[model samples]
Target: MSLETVLILISIGIAAGILSGLFGVGGGIIIVPSLLGVYAFTHFNSPYIVHIAIATSLFTIIFTSLSSAHKHFGHGNVEWKAALYIGLSSAVTVFLFSKIAILLPGEILKQTFSVVLIIVALKMLFDKKGKHEDPAEKKPEVFKPWLCLVIGALSGAIAAFSGLGGGVFVIPLMHYLMKVPFKKAVGTSSAAILITAAAGVISYFINSPAGANSIPYSFGMVDTLSAVPIIAASIPFARVGVYINRKTHHYLLTKLFAVFIIIVSLKLIFF
Candidate 1:
């Protein structure tokens, strides 16, 4: 890697970190697309190296989520019980699906990745942000443990394959199904991403092919050089973002974020 490339990666890291903190996402929203552009431009194909980028993004999220989760947890907003149940279920699914992902052709995987990101961005755009706070009207409990598990499992599988932290659906699921306040659900979901991201990283290690050339300095699929800066930058900026999030409505933030995702996605698709 040239010094110019390292500098570019650093700039990407700072931007990703700021966004991750603001949205409670893994910053793969930024990382994966940026990586795809760079890789395609540079023509670095060490067999399934895109998998390495996804894996590396997950590792960075481990720390980013930890810091953000702790902040939300301290606010008494994180639903540990729900997060744990979902994490366990999703981790298993991620492990299974990741094996399949490794076996697919590389170009197909990129297109699949692009499609998934498009779906996520569109979902964010259309997601109804109902009044976050619930009234005293007696609403029946809607989510059972098994249902939560199912949701988590799907989240895990998708996150592993697409380099997402699964915040897109998790927030809506908890709010609509369990009557969790939007803020609380968002906090808890951020915490859950920590586990889901870790699970994805582990699965990649188990599934990564031997003698794959894209992994220059990696154990399993994580590219440490790419991940280290993301973690370092995301942790502090995310803390600031969390603090800002406390004051601003996350719904508005989500809407703005969706627009950015769409713009970036279009740029990548066309470029």
Candidate 2:
């Protein structure tokens, strides 16, 4: 790859990592779409362009999510119990669905990904931000293990299919359905993405065709040149994002998350 391409990949990585930390996402939201654009604009023109994008995005998330999660962990925001249950449950689903995803048509996968993004954005946009309860006054309901498992499974399958970090749904699912505080949900989701993305990367590697990497220095569907630079660039930026998340209010985070989902959705649909 050219030095110019490496620089571009690094730039993309920096943005993705920051967003990953900021939103507790796996960085796939930025990585997948950006990679797709890069491939398209550079005229890579392979039938596996979408697959490559998703696979490479997932691979990058392995590093990005871990870095972001570590920051959240340091802040004591992650719910370890929830993360454990969700991550393990989702791993199975991600593995199974990823195999199926490889068999599906690329256009169908992209369209489905777009639809899911739209749904998530709408949910975030209209979601009621109820008044925060005083923690000292009354304790919230117990976090159900079964519910966490089910949600993990669902999120994992969808993430595997769409090359997402599963944060789009995972964060909202925890906040709305599970009654987790937005900050906690974000932290927990980041931890879960660490597990889910790893499973996705492994599955994609196994299921992908032997020569799927049309680009140089690729492993299966993952483009190593892009993955390395992006991963490196995203790490420190992810810390910055985590710092911002700690200082920012939840409402702002929600709005920003919603807007990002909408923008990415439109790009996927029209681009």
Candidate 3:
């Protein structure tokens, strides 16, 4: 690889890690568009370019989410029950839909990804701030199973299709509809992304071809050469993101996430 490519990948990793930790997202939002941007700049020609980008992004999320999750766990922000509930449901859909994703046209996937990003960005921008719960009011001890199933299916399907982690959907559901506290929602989303992304990775690998169709230094759809350096670069920064998140105000974090999402959406649409 060229020096320019190396620098780009490393920069993407650093940014992705910080975003993942701060927002409880899997960083796929940043990673996918960045990978696509690189390929576009290099004029890389491959029928599987989008597939490779998505697969590699999901693979990177495995490490990024784990690093973020560990920090969230330490702060006791993770809602273990909610994570487990959503994760189990989301994993099944991710595995099933990723197979379909592997066969879809690249243009179709890209368009779909753009649309999803737009929706997510708009939601973040307009979502109501969390209302303070009365101290005497009792919150439910458990999440509804039906709601979990619906969120998981939608999140997993969209996430698997775009190679973005399910945390994008999960965080919103937790924070907005479920009324989960911001920090706990982020922590739980990060934890659940581990499972959702893992399932998508497995499905992509299984459906990917070997031999001529596979890229050099790749395992199945995943580009190992790029993923390794990115993972390494991102891990340390994830801790930094978590620390910053703890110190940052919730309103600031929410606005930051919205802006970041909008920027990513525009890139995917116009790049």
Candidate 4:
């Protein structure tokens, strides 16, 4: 890769990492598209490269989220019961869907994943417009096994296709569905992302074409070589994002972020 490509990847990593930490997201939305942006700029034409990028980003999240989760769990904020419920239910779905994801052409998967990001982000933004996590909201009912499994399954499917941890969905579910406190929901979601992302990545590796190149860290695959710097730099920035999240008026920022995601998704789908 050229110097320009390297720099672009580094930028994507740091930026995505910060976003991941601040919002407790998986960073796939940013990483996958940023890989496309890298490909567009570098003139690479490998079909599965974007897939690799998404996979690699998910792999990276395994570490990033673990670290973040551990730290947040330090505050006794993580909710083990809820996270386990979400992870268990979704495990089967993530496995099945990741296999399906491997079968589709990489380009289509890339575009579809982008669209998923757009839709989820829009939901998040709109949700934020109202009370995001009102303590006054109703409490979760008796934890039904089926309901938990269904939600977990949905999260897995989303992660399998889009490389997100499903934390975006998970947090809201905790808030609106389970009546979890906002901070606890965020902590639980971060932990949940680790489990769900790990399961999805394993499925991706298993279902992809044989050989090193099919998964992350291979030549054109997940491009871990390119994604590493981003992961490293994100450590500092993620903390910053978390701090900023507590202080800033997130309404405008969330809307702006959502608009950007929509524009980028449109470009990838059409351009």
Which digits, one per residue and each the tens of the lDDT, describe model 2 over residues 5-59? 7888899999988898999888776788788878766778777787888889989
User: Which has the greatest TM-score?
Assistant: 2
Looking at candidate 2, what is the lDDT of residue 199?
90
Cα TM-score per model: 0.81, 0.89, 0.86, 0.77
In model 2, where is the ten-residue run with the lowest total lDDT? 130-139
Question: After TM-score superposition, what is the CA distance of residue 105 in candidate 4 from its true location, in Å?
Answer: 5.4
Listed per candidate, the RMSD to the true structure in angstroms reads 3.8, 2.7, 3.1, 4.2
> In candidate 3, what are the lDDT values of residues 82-197, reduced to their tens digit?
88878888889989888887777545655676677678768767766543431112454347778777777776886777777777668767766676777778888889888888
lDDT of 1: 0.71
| Model 4 misplacement above 4 A | 105-133, 136-144, 210-221, 248-271
Query: What TM-score number comes out for model 1?
Result: 0.81
lDDT of each: 0.71, 0.82, 0.79, 0.67
Q: Give the TM-score of candidate 3.
A: 0.86
lDDT of 4 by residue, 126-158 (tens): 864334534423455345666667668777877
List the candidates ranked by lDDT, beginning with the highest.
2, 3, 1, 4
